[model samples]
Target: MERIQEALAKARAQRQQGSATRTEHAAPPKINPSVDDAWGALSPFKLNRALLKSHRVVAAETGRDAAPYDLLRTKIIHQAQMNNWRRVAIVSPDMGAGKSTTVANLAFSFERQRDMRVLCIDLDLRRPSLHKVLGQKSDHSMSDVLNGHVRFSEHGLRLGERVAFGLNNGPAPNPSELLLSQAARDTLEGIEQDYAPNLTLFDISPLNASDDNIAFLQNVDCAIIIAAAETTPIKRIDQAERQVAELTNVMGIVLNKCRYISDNDGYDYY
Candidate 1:
């Protein structure tokens, strides 16, 4: 914790010492919408080294294959900065479309930004995998927070002080109902108010799989739709876009899992 604090302090100092023009893209003043006492209690825990490797997520480092994530991250950040969008949801047209993987990788990619703070909340209740993807394990989950059993910030896994996560744990029989409830909205708002992250990402269930994704989308500022190459149906993608467009801005689409044979330079996202 001490080390992380020092690193953050040093980074901030460097940011402050930069040329005067650096503040040109400064974030908008806060409205302080969700501030609460729970914000101060979030714990810091180290991610599992082996687990990160298995998921191909390295928070601070950008490898060749992760290049696409870096590109996506830059574009999203530019848009978020321009629009003052703090919360963004990642969803796909259907299951097995690699939305979870895209969300996880994007979170890590955003975490790499020295001046940015990111929070990733896994809302894919029926098939929660963000915690596993981040190689995190905990007694507290989003369910506990929603059930009023725990504070929203109490059990987060940290990637330095800048990156934190509130992951879903067990399947909920009534996932859509839970997401639409005021309790769920309050929990997410509480986390945002507390952490004051530059970006908040919700890893949601596939659009056609259940009502969960659509319900969750209502709370976020914008969304990204990830489509699997050759695997996802065009009709479903169109339907998902129509649904999300009515709720929030469709930031852009990410095409994943296309056949990429290794070449002289590196692998391509295509």
Candidate 2:
């Protein structure tokens, strides 16, 4: 009986030690909340103005014959044609390439122009600038959700009657890690289930600067590569196309900031 008690005591001790070890090893995940930095970067009217300008450029170049804003609406409807792909990643070759502006306007156009349910996720963890483009004050972001600092619903903001997803900036770990995390996948799945939108746009980081964009590409059904007019070299566009093709289901390219001199602008859309 004494030997039996000793064996049971030893087993209890082992269990206690295991519990202690687990408790000691487990720590709450850390996150960086760059809310002030994100909100401080914008004025309310700045994004609206940019959207208006881009819309005008597209309208004039395409010979849409409608108001620029109306033309923008038409373009967004065209973007949602990807099969089983509610999420679309918008990317560019490099910075100052007008991707953020294009994505914000595209999201806006999706909601206002088509009356479709849309969620615009700003997955550009490195140098995230979507908040400024959307004129939203994001208290929590994608980073927060990934690390358990917040929930996905908590980080979402509604701007101009459309949904915008933002992520907080923190110590720059490999941004791809977060994008490929299970949390991101589940969050996207929830988005697909809850809204079941005609389109969901993910404004990802520039491909040349970071690989974060690639992490979400395979998960999303398609990608849209943006090229600026007169500036984006052919090689750069090719590289963007190749990169997206390698990682994602490539939809096609959208030539932004193109001149209105050509008659083939609108008709070229396939």
Candidate 3:
């Protein structure tokens, strides 16, 4: 115990000295930048590394032709190019299916892998959770934009070096009614214009034939439906695919929260 105490004291003294030296040499602190501003200002190098690891894990489990995120990124960009689509919507069969998680990761992957300016707009409205998933505040949401209460440039939430996201905590009056408003159209248009050649992902509600997903689909370039493992039935997946088909171009389906084993038979993913 005496030896341990001495070692601890020495370590603490060294740390304090180092910290003092650093502080003395450190430059003055800069202004606290807004979320979107910070995102746009920072480069995507560091975030890309984290995304690469995620892709490797996913690819390993799916047995897909390409690397995990690389495969998805390539597919998404290809779809965008083929259809001249800039907006992508990530939806699910229902709530609690990891759609927001997938959207956040996908946005990160796109920015990291494709080197494109990516923005994810959470239009879930009724049940907004993208902020929680991304560890961001939900005070400012897409609801503000849809209601013409806030400007897009002001409310966009930055997620990383170059990724920004927006949230909507259900628009005024009724979300369904707001979905059809001209303000919604203008907001989408503004985003497309400002983030030119950028990829935008809309995290929207489930499609139950005549739900908001149908209307939301009209604004995006393509849509990806998320289905939870075991929780989502093939019938619903089929229905989702079919419903998205009613639109011009549909991206595909994401099997969310999948479990996988490594080639060495080790478990992963916490």
lDDT of 3 by residue, 78-159 (tens): 8776655666888887777877777766665665553566777888777777666554544567777778778766777554
Predictions in order: lDDT? 0.72, 0.59, 0.62
Off-target runs (Cα >4 Å) in candidate 1 are: 1-41, 58-60, 260-267
lDDT of model 2, residue 12: 45
| Span of 10 residues, lowest total lDDT, candidate 1 | 18-27
TM-score of each: 0.80, 0.67, 0.70
List the lowest-lDDT window of 10 residues for candidate 2.
23-32
Tens-place lDDT digits, model 1, residues 207-262: 76766765666567779999989988888788778877766678988878886766
Candidate 2 residues 62-114, lDDT tens each? 23433343564465456544243455788898877777777755654554543
Superior candidate under TM-score, 2 versus 3: 3
Best by TM-score: 1
Give the clash count for each candidate.
0, 1, 2
Best by lDDT: 1
The lowest-lDDT stretch of 10 consecutive residues in candidate 3 is 22-31
Error of 2 at 56 (Å): 9.8
> Total backbone clashes of model 3?
2
